[model samples]
Target: MSTFTENAPGVAEQSPEAAAGFTLNHSMLRVKDPERSLHFYTHVFGMRLLRKLDFPEMQFTLYFLTRLLPEDSVPEDPDERTVWTFSQRGLLELTHNWGTEDDPDFAYHNGNDAPQGFGHICFSVPNLESATTWFEDMGVEFVKRPGTGKMPNIAFVKDPDGYWIEIVQPDLTAGLGR
Candidate 1:
């Protein structure tokens, strides 16, 4: 298990004085079964399982996968194994820490659409139309379609695990929509 501290030393020194340039390293999601989530992410979306670690001592497994780059292109540094590569875009980290025998297998549920606390992860696509169509063809259900006025030129889709993802056309509001 990895521990993340928001106000860590170096992380708070990247800005002038007390202004911290905090960067999001990754989002950790505890899953009941890593294999099941892996299959869902791989088959549904085009994500590749980059690496997996079986910590017998910790009694858990950590699998890092992403849609940014192929698994073979990942660096050989074990320390940096958790780092994912993207095509000029940030990468996502899907964490599946093994649950205990008493832990309940909670299915994914859409949380309140807010930026507070830990919410759903959002991804941007080049074309929202094609992306939505592709997801629909795969039998994926979306929580909302575009044009609700919540987010212009953007649509929201959910994964098999019910994790929300936002698909938006790049630069949708770049003067053209105005």
Candidate 2:
């Protein structure tokens, strides 16, 4: 990895040059079951279904999810929606291969168990108490419940695929090193 510093070898110590702005389009997760993943993200994390793409020949499907702001609205026209969805940022992309979900023994490594690589994703909520209570009612899997982990203020929940997701309160994240 390359590091940019004010006092690196031949680099000047003066102010750095400005760069163009860019948005984080999306982060993808391959899912064995689209229905299960969609349910967890939309219901538990409060994300909206932005767009869906299906590749019949490739035997795969892609689902795009994003948390909708109060002021945001879904466009009705296909062209407009496509343009709008691609332009937005902070999206979670769920990809599903056609036959994987139905196979009893087939499963994707959720980056937590053996052969680990990726860690976990996060969601910041307005009220942690309310969110926990709701999750309790919904019977969601809890990898690390609130006030139980190292950070008593943060919580971790697991999706259907056993993917750990950290849940944080916006105001309390400061102590958790947001």
TM-score of each: 0.65, 0.85
Candidate 1: residue 79 Cα off by (Å): 6.4
Whole-model lDDT per candidate: 0.63, 0.85
Give the runs in model 2 whose Cα sits over 4 Å from its true position: 1-19
In model 2, what are the clashing residue pairs, if there are any?
none
Q: Which number leads on TM-score?
A: 2
lDDT of 2: 0.85
Model 2 weakest lDDT span, ten residues long: 13-22
Error of 2 at 137 (Å): 0.5
lDDT score of residue 7 within candidate 1:
73
- Model 1 ranges off by over 4 Å: 1-23, 69-72, 76-89, 99-105, 108-110, 113-117, 175-178
